[model samples]
Target: MKKLIINADDFGYSRGVNYGIIDSHQQGVLTSTTFMTNMPGAEHAVELANQNPDLGVGVHLVLTCDRPLLDTHKTIVDANGDFRKLGFYKGAFTIDYEEVYDEWKAQIEKFLSFGLEPTHLDSHHHINSFGDIPEVFLKLAKEYNLPVRNNMDITEDIKTTDSFSYLIETALKDDQSLNELFESNQTVEVMSHPAYLDKKLMDTSSFTYPRIDEVEFLTHPRIIELIDARSDIQLSTFKDI
Candidate 1:
């Protein structure tokens, strides 16, 4: 059987996006969500996770946008101590690897402080794969015995994983066209940003309107029917692996 993990990224991004993530889990096909530690609606997302323990919650390690919660002098952040979205690409700026590792470890610790164990770990904007970050997260995953997303593979210490496929960004057609997802014998993680558009999301980032539409597509009846028809496809969570 093909196991599919329908995980929504950016939980705790904002209240509106948080609501959409929960809505997808409760009313749609969403099976898991990853949380941003120091984002605006982090506590709310934790509350929602407590209320719905069936939905797997994982840490979404962040490096951009929010202010650094661990250190004040990290070069990754700007003059105001907030992460700069600009110089985030590879080889853009020299980075302090140890400082970044500590900051990321703190993010995971922040998530654990809520009295819940994370099922897996992934990064916000997939930052763990960029510029001296692969080792930091891999080390923590081994220390904590958790699964880091497949975006960065460090070795046997890190568990093997399947990378998530974005429905809209990829050429996979629409949300109902889910047949292509389970073509592999191995587990597959389908990543999505299913959310309602709100003023807060619009003001903060350019990734807004598509999320609003994704909520509609994910909750459609046809998608559910498609799943039911496939005896080979099994809906799953990250912890199931």
Candidate 2:
């Protein structure tokens, strides 16, 4: 069987995001979520996870656009200790990776302290796309004995989106270690931001409502509900296989 972990990204960016994630998990197809430790409602998201017991929670490492956990004057997006913007799609920025590594380690430590031994790690903005950062992510994952989302979907459906397909293809080419992880049979987290068209989300971001709707109806919800809610459905965390 092809096992899948339907994940939701940006768990703590806003109250609306948090609400949407939890509601999607409870009422829709979301089986896992990645949390932004420094985002707006992180604590509440954790609390909800504790209550639900079935939601898989992982750290969504924020390195671009969003503020850093560590205060550094000369880093990429850190301008006087706050994030330069709220999105990273603009362009890749350069940073001193050596200094950033120390801060990244601390953030992981903080997440673990909250009783979430993350099963995997993924960057906030796919910042892993940058040079050497993917190496940092691999090192961190190995150190923690966790998985970094390998993003190896080669099936025909994934090819429909050229950008997404290209991302997966590049990951497959660059990530040799993921070969074993692929064979190990543990689920890799795959996420999408699908939502109803509403004033709340529309006013906040330029995310196309039409695309969101396409994902909502396209993702296999019935299968997800059956699998996630199965009494055989053992609760899974980032650390659980």
Candidate 3:
């Protein structure tokens, strides 16, 4: 059997987002989530995650469109202390490698402070896709003894809901390391954002409709809900394995 870890990203972004994530956990196949340390509702996400101890949580490292966990990088924030408007799918790429590393390290600290035993690391807006960031992120992941999501172009298979069938082909086309990681690890977490669109999310600069639909289809929430609600069930975590 193919074991999978489905992780929801942007936890603690907004109340709507937090509610959606928690509800998805109650109502869907959401086994895990990545917390945004710098967002408004981070504490709320933490509370919910703590309540649902079965849900795995990790750090959603924020380097763009949000305040840096470190004191540097005023470029990422405006005068009001609100993060700049570089939403996902449209952030302008920059080569601020030193700043990125500093901020990411601080975020790791922040996640630890929240008592989140992170399963892995992933960047906000896939910022690691920019110049030199991927190498730096991987280096930190290795140092921290955590797994990082490498770009394997799984998004294409994800779009078709044929992830099982096309994973190997897409992984080969995108990154060989990802294929090796998938093969070697008995469990791997795939970072994703799946939620219902509330006003806050809909009005946000980065709202995308396809992602919502993808969440609905890929999660298959109804089945999971029935199984858990109708029968005794125990969620598997890294510790379990």
Candidate 4:
């Protein structure tokens, strides 16, 4: 059997994002999502997660979008103390691994404070996979006993999917069927950012507008039908891994 985990990232980025994620899970094939504990919509997202008991919620450990939960950091923050944007990570940059470890632990603790048992771990902007950061990420995951979204480089004995793909739009653009995308891997994790457009999202995120399209595609009848008709494909959550 091929297990497919369609995980919606940025669950608590904004009210629009939180609502869209819940809609995708309740009405579409999305089985799991990761929550951004530092965002403005964090509490709202947690409430929604409590209401929807079946949606596997996890920590979307943030390093790029918002301010740290703890005090200002030495390497992870900018002059203004907010997190440096994605461009900062793209360039040659230096970061303290210890700082990353502490901030991420705070995020996980905050998630637990809500009485929600996190299903797994991932990161905002895939920063956890960046230079030497996987060491810290894996360390935290081990301590917390949580699975992770496959980083594709780490060979450690961590729990994760066999393969990870951020190719939902690309696959659709190339007219590739979902089953064909899953054929080669026994387990696959498809990363997605599906949200409704809102003032906060447009102001804070560069990857806006397309999220609206993603919600449409994710909740589309055809996509759900395709998954339902395929007996070989099992829609799963990280908890099941």
* Winner by TM-score: 4
RMSD of each: 2.2, 8.3, 7.8, 1.7
Candidate 3 — what's its lDDT?
Answer: 0.61
Poorly placed runs, candidate 4 (over 4 Å):
170-176
In the range 104-187, model 3's lDDT, one tens digit per residue, is 888888878988798767777776666556677776776677755545332221111112222312232222434453564544
Model 4's C-alpha root-mean-square deviation from the true structure amounts to 1.7
Q: lDDT, candidate 3, residue 7?
A: 65
Query: In candidate 1, what are the lDDT values of residues 38-103, reduced to their tens digit?
Result: 888888888999999989899898887677777654678877778868455555678788877888
Model 4 steric clash pairs: none
lDDT of 2 by residue, 1-241 (tens): 3244556677666666676677767766566778788765678777877877677777787765346677654655544676555343355656677755766787788788889757567777676545666667666766776655554322331111112211212222222423332455434444555444445445645664643552443244644444445442342444444
How many collisions per candidate?
Answer: 0, 3, 0, 0
**122-231, model 4: which lDDT tens digit per residue?**
99999988888888998998999899988646555778998888877654332256656766778888888889999999998899988888888889988888778778
Clashes of 4: 0
By TM-score rank, best first, the candidates go 4, 1, 3, 2
> Is candidate 2 or 4 superior in lDDT?
4
Clashing residue pairs found in predicted model 2: 119-238, 119-239, 230-233
lDDT of 2: 0.57
